[model samples]
Target: MSETLEQRAAPAPDGPEQVRAAPIGAPVEGSADEQLPTPTRRANPFRRALAGATEVLGPWARVVWAAAQPVVAVVSGLGWVVLGIGFLATLAGFILGWSELVFLGFVPLAAILVSIAFLFGRSTFRISIHLNPSRVTVGERAIGQVLITNPGSRATTPTRLEVPVGFGLAEFALPAIPKDGEHEELFAVPTNRRAVIPAGPAVSVRGDQLGLLRREVRWTEPVELFVHPETTRLHPTAAGLIRDLEGLVTKTITNNDISFHALRGYVAGDDRRYIHWKSSAKTGQLMVRQFEETRRSQLTMVMTSDSRYYGDADEFELAVSLTASIATQVIIDQVPISVVTDRLALRTHTVTSFLDDTCRLQLAEGTFDTPRTFARETTKRLPAPSVVIIVAGSQLEAQEYRGIQRLFGPDVNVFGIRVERGARASIKDVAGMNVMTVGALSDLSKVMSRAL
Candidate 1:
C-alpha cells in the first residue's frame, strides 16, 4: 500500500534511527510542524545566578572602571603584576594561617604605596620645540632645540623630560629653575635616509626608582622634519623639454589652432569661423582652414614605488632623486607638471612642497605592479600631456618599457629613466621611447641632456 506524506517524513518509532543529543538550552533540530521532545538537562544554577548579578551590577562596575582609569594609566605593567600577587598572597595567607606569605606580600604592597607619592606634584612650564631649518637633504645635520621656561612665580621642582625623535628617544634632567628662568636642551636628529621624521611633543615623566608607576605630562606639540632626497640640478631649460610662450606643436590637425598647417574642402560639420573666404572665392568651393594641434607644455611623471621593481633600497632612492631633480627644474621654470607614483600623487605647485612630498615616498607592493598597468591607470586621471616621463628601478624589464610607450600616442614624447646603482649610464631607444639608464645621481644631468 502507498504511504502518506506525513508518515514518510516522520521517523519510525521502532527503527534503528537514533536521536542526536543537542547542547543544553539549544533548540532541537526538527520540522516546525512536528512536536519534538524537550531537553531534559537544565542550566546550572550558579551560572544563572552569576549572570543575574552581573546585569544588576553593570552600572556600578562602569563607575568603578571610570574612577580607576587614572590609576591604570599611571601604573606600569610590572606594578599590576606585583599588586595582584600581593593581594592573592595576603588573602591566601589569612585563610591558611601562614605568616611568611603575608610578610612576603606586604613588601610589594608597601613599595607600590610609596611609589604613588612620587607622582603627586604637577608640572607647569612653557615648552617650545624649534627645528633649525626644518627641512634638510639626506645625510645632512638636522638640529632641534627644546626651550623650557618656568612661568610660575615660585621655583620649579626637578624633573625628567623625554623627547621622542623619530624612532629614538632623548631624555634630559631638568634642575630646579628660579622664577622667570629658562632652560634649553639641544638634540641632533639622524638623517641617514629620506623620510619624514617627527621631532617632538616633549613629555615630562615623573616616576620612582623602583619602576612601579610613571606619570607623563605633554608640554609641546609635535613637528615634522622633512629629510628630502639628494637631488641634482638639471639645466634651467630642461633640454628643450619646455617651450617658453608657445606650446608644443603636434602633427594632429584641428579646425582652429595657433599653428596653421593647410587648407581643405569644407566638411558638413565644419565650423563657420574657420572658413577661408579668399581660398573659397578662388577655388569655387567652400574651403576651410586646417591647423596643426598644439598642446600646452604639460609634463606628467610616473614613478613606480613597487618593491618588486627595485633591486635594493639604494636603487629606489636613486630613482626618487632622479625624478625629483627633473621635476624641480620643471617647477622652477613655472611649467604645468604632475608627479605621481603607483600609490599616490605628489604636489607640484612649488619646489619646496614638491621635494617635501618626495621625502615621504616609500617602496611597497601596490595594485599596479608593472609599468603598463601603472601608466594605464594613471593616464585616465590626468590631462593630455605633451611630455610623459616614467621613472623606475633597473629591475623593470625591457618589454615593460615598450608596453608603457604603446599606451600613449605618437604625438606624446615618452621618456623612461631606469636607475641602477654602480652601472654604466647610457640612453637607448626602446620601441621609439627614449630609455635612459642612470647609475649615479651625478650622471642624471648628462644623461638627460643627451636624451632630450
Candidate 2:
C-alpha cells in the first residue's frame, strides 16, 4: 500500500467534511447491522451415537477386564520395572564413564524398548464377541454378532477377551492382530420372530508401543436382527387317531365345510368335492369352494405382559418365544385365532393367515391392553366362529383366562399353554381349559399336538 492510501485511511482529528453526522446517543442514518459468526458443530454420521453408557468397555469386555486386570498388571509391572532399572543404570554410566557404555546403554535402551513393547502389545490385543444368530425373532433371541478385533498396535499375548451372554460372561484369548485383520470368529445365532438380528457392542483393544498403555474401545451399532417365525406343524398322536392340524386331511365332524373360505372358478384337475353346484347353476359360471380344515373351536391366544410370572432375564424371553411359536402354529393350522393381551393394542386379527412381523413383535410384548375389550370389538366386526387358544406365560391366572373365554359363545373351546423356564415342564389345570405345559421351544410342538 502506498503512503497516499495510508493517509486516506487514517481518521482525521476533525469530523467528516460538511457531512451531516448523527447526534450522540441517536441512531446512525443508514448504518447496516451485521451479526457475529459462530462456530458450528459437526456430527458424525458414520459412528453410532453413544447412548446411555459410561466408559468404552462393553458389557462382555468389562467382566473379562475385571478378572484379568490384576494378572496383567503383575506381569506388566515385572517386565517394565526391570527394563526401567536397566535404563537408569545405562544413563548413569553414560554420564560418568565410557566404560560399558554399550552394556550400560542397554539399560535405558531396554527401558524404552520395554515401554514401546508394552505400548505395542496394548495396541495389538484382540477382543472377540460371539452372538448366536445374526438373525433372530423379536422377543426371542436378540444375539447379534460376535466380534473379535484389535485395540492395540504391539503384539499382546495372554490377552483376555470375555463377552457376556444372558447374565453370565465367557472369556477367550484372541490371536495377535496381524497386519491383515481379526482372525476367524464364529457365532451361532438363535431363531428370531422379527426379520432383523440385534447388533452388539464392538470391542477394540490396543496395546501401547511398549506394552504399557492399554486402550479398549467399545462400539455399539444398535441393530435388531429380524428372523421370521418357523412354520408350525401340529402332529397329533392319539389312542387310535393320528393327525397333523396343517396339510389336507379330512376329519369326521358335524361341519365338513366349516373352514371353506370362498368359491373360485373351477379349472383343470379340480377336486369334484369342491364344486358348488347351486352357485354354478345360479350364475351359470363354474365355481368351487376353497375349503380349509376347521379348528376344534373358537380360539383366543393370550400373550402375557406381566413380567412377575414371566420372571426376569431369560425366563421372560422364553415366555415370549412360546407366544410366537404358538401364534405361528395357529396361523399355519388355519385356526381362527385372536391374540389377546393386557395393555395397549399389539395384534388382534384372526390368524387364518400369516400375520406380518410387526404384528408378531407386538403380540410378544403383550402391548395389546385388554383381551375382553378386543374380543368384544372383534366380535362386533368379524362374525366368524372361532375357538380360543391361550398362548401365554404361566404367570397369568386362571381368572383372566376364564374372563376372556366368556367373551365368545358358551361352546368356544379354549386351551391354555403354560410356558416353562427350561427344558422340562408338567401340565397344570387353569380354569376349565386344558393347560399344556412345556419346557423350551422344542416342547411347543408337543403342546400343539395335544391341542389337535
Candidate 3:
C-alpha cells in the first residue's frame, strides 16, 4: 500500500524525535541521494581575458624588465620626467598641428640625447683610497687620499670621482690622464666626535651638468675610520681598584679560603680538609678553620645605552670616555674584564679592538627594564664578577642607582659613575655601592682615586 507524503515525512516515535534548525548559509543534513539548489554566476569576460593574458605574457614581461633595468638605472628621476613630458608634448603637437609645442618638446629631447654622450666612455682608470692612520682619537686630524692611475695605453677622458665620507660626499675633479699616469688628491676628514666613519669605495661618476644622466663605476672597497673616544691615562694604582691576583677579602666567613679569619665548630657539610686538628683537640669538638671569604677580582663594566638617562650628547660622551678609561686601564694591567652595554657586549681583549667597538657605541631606546635589572641579567651569563662598574648619565635618579647596588651580593663591590657636564666631581656611598659624579673626562681619574 502507498503511504501519504505527511506520514512519510513525520518523525518516528522511537524517542520523542528532535529537529534542529541549520544555520544560515550552512549546508543542511540530507540523505545521500538528496539534491540541493546551488546558485551560479557567470564569469566576467574581462577578468578571464586578463588572467589568460597574464599567464601567457608573464615570461615575456620578465624578459623586458630585465632588459630595461640598466636603462632605468642610468636615467635620473628628472631625466625620466623630462622624457615623459617631451613624448607627450610631441604627440599633442602633431595631433593639434601646433608648431610651438613641437619645438618646445624637441628642445628637451635634444638635450637628453646630447647628455648621453658624457656616459659613453668607459671608466678605465684604476682607483684606490688610502686613509693614513685608519684609527684616531677624537679631535685628531685624519687624511684620506684617492689615487687614480691610467692603467691602459690610451689616454682617458676627464671624470669626477665621488668618495662617500661618513654622511658627506667628497668629489675630486680629474684631468685627462696620459697612459701610466697617476693622480692623487688628499682630503681631511672631520673627527670632532667619537664615531666609526666609513670612507669610500671610490666610484668614478660620469654625469652631465644638468644631471640628466649618471653612470658610476665602483673601484675600491670601503674603509672604516674609527674615531675612538678620547681616554685619560689613569694612575698605576687605579688598576689596583679593578685588578687583584690574590683576591679581595670580604666579611662573609667560609670554611675554606686563603684569608684565615677564625676557627669555628664544623657543620655537617663542612669539608674535612678545612678541619683544624689542634683547635678540635682543645675544644673537644670538630672545629674547622674559618676564612674571610675571598673573591677572584673580575671586573664587569656596564655602560647604559638608554638615551633617556642622558641630559645631552656631551654627558653621554663623558660617560663613554670614563668607561673607556677605566676599561682600558684594566686591559693594560692584564686583568680579566668584561665590558657590555644594555644591548650587547663589547670586545675587550685588546685596547685597539675595545676602543674600536666603543666607537660604534650609540645611544638607543632601551627595551629592557631598569639599569639594575639589565646589569643583573647581563652579568648572570658571564662569570661571577667581584667588581661591577655601572656607567650612566646624570639623568639617572638616585633611587635607580641604589637599585643597581642592591642587585649584587654583599661580597661584590659595585661602583657607579654618573656623568654630568659642569658638575663638580664627588663620590658618595649609596646602598653599599660607591657612586661617583664627574663633570668631565679629566675629573674621572680624581673621583676614581677617592672612590676606591
TM accuracy, model 1: 0.81
What is candidate 2's lDDT per residue for 100-151, written digit by digit as tens? Answer: 8648668555555555454343344343444444433333433323454555
Minimum summed lDDT over a 10-residue window in model 1 is located at 1-10
TM-scores, each model vs. reference: 0.81, 0.38, 0.81
lDDT (10s digit) by residue, model 1, range 24-45: 2333232211111221111234
Query: What's the lDDT for all of these models?
Result: 0.76, 0.46, 0.75
Q: Which stretches of candidate 3 lie over 4 Å from their true place?
A: 1-63, 251-256, 264-290
lDDT of 2 at 210: 52
Runs of candidate 1 exceeding 4 Å displacement: 1-64, 88-98, 236-238, 265-288
Q: Model 2 TM-score?
A: 0.38
Looking at model 2, residue 109 earns an lDDT score of 57
